[model samples]
Target: MNTRPGLSDTEPAPCLRIGLLWHSVNSPNLGVGALTISNIAIMEKVANELGVSVEFIVLGWMDKSFPVYVQAPNVRALALNGRACKPGGAFSAAVGDCDLVLDIGAGDSFADIYGWRRFLYLAYTKWLVKRAGRPLVLSPQTLGPFKNRLARAIAAFLIRRSDLVFARDRMSVDYARDIGVSRKIIETTDVAFRLPYEKPSPWPGPKEKTVVGINISALLYQGGYTRDNMFQLSIDFPALMDRLLDYFAGIPDCEVVLVPHVLSHRAVEDDLSVCQQVQRAHPGVSVAPAFRSPSEAKSFIAGLDFFIGARMHACIAALSTGVPVAPLAYSRKFMGLFYALDYRDVIDCAAETTESALEAVTLAFGRRDELARMARHSAALAQDRLGIYEDGIKDFLASRIPNRRPAPVAAKSRLSA
Candidate 1:
């Protein structure tokens, strides 16, 4: 066989080229990072079991300041952003080269609630992959809550075209069916549940007291994106955070920590800013350090005796690690995922009053030992449920790629060394 130019004869070819759409290994939102890390673990496992060499091409919202940190030699991030949507751009070429595309829709971007821009971003990625005649798979993520006709149609069209659709919760499954999409939907738990974390060595804290962590979403702190209660929750979010803090502060020997999950530079998206402000209002409250990766955030949360948070993934990090967690739910995704895990110690922020929500959280904290038992039990259930998803992934990857292949060119643009 003639050696292709620029391709050394000694270099082994990758058996498969996989494109992960809406997958960002580096993001201020640790939740997104959690999904990215968990999904990659699955892909790597599937590839190894199939005896295939795989190269992952991660494509999503990338910025120069936040370089991709995939921590894999075979993974690379394309510099192209929205420009990749065009027919003749590098994204198109990247798609044409891929053997398969796994789109997690940024966990729940398949829903129209975030805005038209995000929905279209996900829709176009699916459309372009299908147009390129490549296999498109919807990695386990929330499917939909498309409010309008146009959004519904667009979502249904992509869901229908996808080679496989894995819904992370039952509500997503129901919503997909409601939108007239029944086929190709596999119900599973959030990938964050399976996200890996490092066990932190004993961190210096008041060892005799209950160490509590509260993750306050800056978006909700200022009343959603518009800063005017855009999520339409009945309760006032700012008031709830204030009340929870005061309640915890009054408890003797309780060491409270402000943990920020979404660390975006954008004022509204930056949890650290809000957490700092929160700490000032109530002195003696410690602030958690800014973590470089999702695993780091999970590890810090793992040390907490109890965690209550508005961010679903932050709560997930706690509960999944056997820390008693009471999720401050602002959306249906919370109820869907946790309930499916057989964990019901959730505070419905969307529906409850600020006072009532605080009350529920206080009650949950009072039952810390019980919640810990349930958290451990739920973690076990999560493992059992996630096993089904792992099996599904194994079958899908095994059938998609052959055992033998010619050596392919190495990726030029790398996310991390």
Candidate 2:
């Protein structure tokens, strides 16, 4: 270890070790992939510009046997499941050398809204990071609508101890304040907004017609398909999707394309199958090619004239690419993100009736041109917001390096060398 006490204003600090935990880089959800890659790229750029090397210990490597999508020489992927199995053995050994720990938390696992199991997993990970005696940073992600008392307590405990917590939207910031957290909290936009998008040369459908992209979530489709919801509000999901397809199909010179944002290795969990079912039901409707990465999916979305999506990331992929979207929001995360972007016109599946959702979708489709213009402007602003997050991260890293002059011993060694 370089034992220099502090970095000078003129010179770069020594190598810094950072461990980024709690995000599955290889998740079927391409948005997760985008976040993972963006986080590493941002940190690496900061380190490189400062003339310091960074060793990233990525704790949420989903499958070590398989190649990680976010590949870098400095990034080391340690399987989280394997680490959990070994308990203190692997996690402690892997993270012991880290100077700081960043809990990315897969965007929105900080609360127990999904279930108690997820909350427990996140709590345990935060506890481990806190125990390491390093500055624990909560990367830009959604905080909570923690209904459970125990869950709220755990979240408050972990968040209070965080050196820095970057809430992706104002709602999350409000959430942190509601939970009585006094820690340093900065409201930032989703890092995925900064993901690179390339426009496809020949758009997926006919050039004469408008290309509308639809992304369906299999998880949502399976949970009672509308009249029944895992939550209180129930709109038949499949019926709603069918209605949207029929409405668009009736439009002159409009092409409907089913775009799956998640292609799980597991057959049942995959969005591709759900998209196919929709395609089969509608004769002229087409299914987009299975995308290999988030950037690829975003690129496909870039080719669309309009997008209506059930998956939050797919909506993100669309909005980030300046494609107009009528997000079928099933959770608060969607509302919060769109709210931050100042982009309204969302169809809340959990709150709206089938007729209301259909009306919203119809209005969105009819005003696609105006919505597209707004989306482009919003995306430009969203990308700009990422700069704030970058600065925050850089400052956090720099703070860890003391401001004092290099130790006499280190200075002597440098002089001799």
- List TM-score per model, in order: 0.92, 0.88
- 357-412: candidate 2 lDDT, tens digit per residue: 98999899889888888888878888778888888888877766554232222110
Global lDDT of each candidate: 0.82, 0.77
**Model 1, residue 356: displacement in angstroms?**
0.9
Number of backbone-clashing residue pairs for each candidate, in the order shown: 2, 5
Clash pairs detected, candidate 1: 13-407, 13-408
| After superposition, candidate 1 runs with Cα above 4 Å error | 1-14, 201-206, 403-417
lDDT tens digits by residue: candidate 1, 1-417: 224243455656447888988888787788887888787777767666655567778878875555455666677777546676788788889988888898888887888888888788788878889989998989888877899899999889889999988888888889888989879688888887878777767758747888999999998888878888878887888888888888888989899999999888789999999999989998979899987778888989999999989899999999899999989887888899999888998888778888888889999999999999999999898888777788887787766664436536433222221
Q: What's the residue-level lDDT of 31 in candidate 1?
A: 88
Model 2 score (lDDT): 0.77
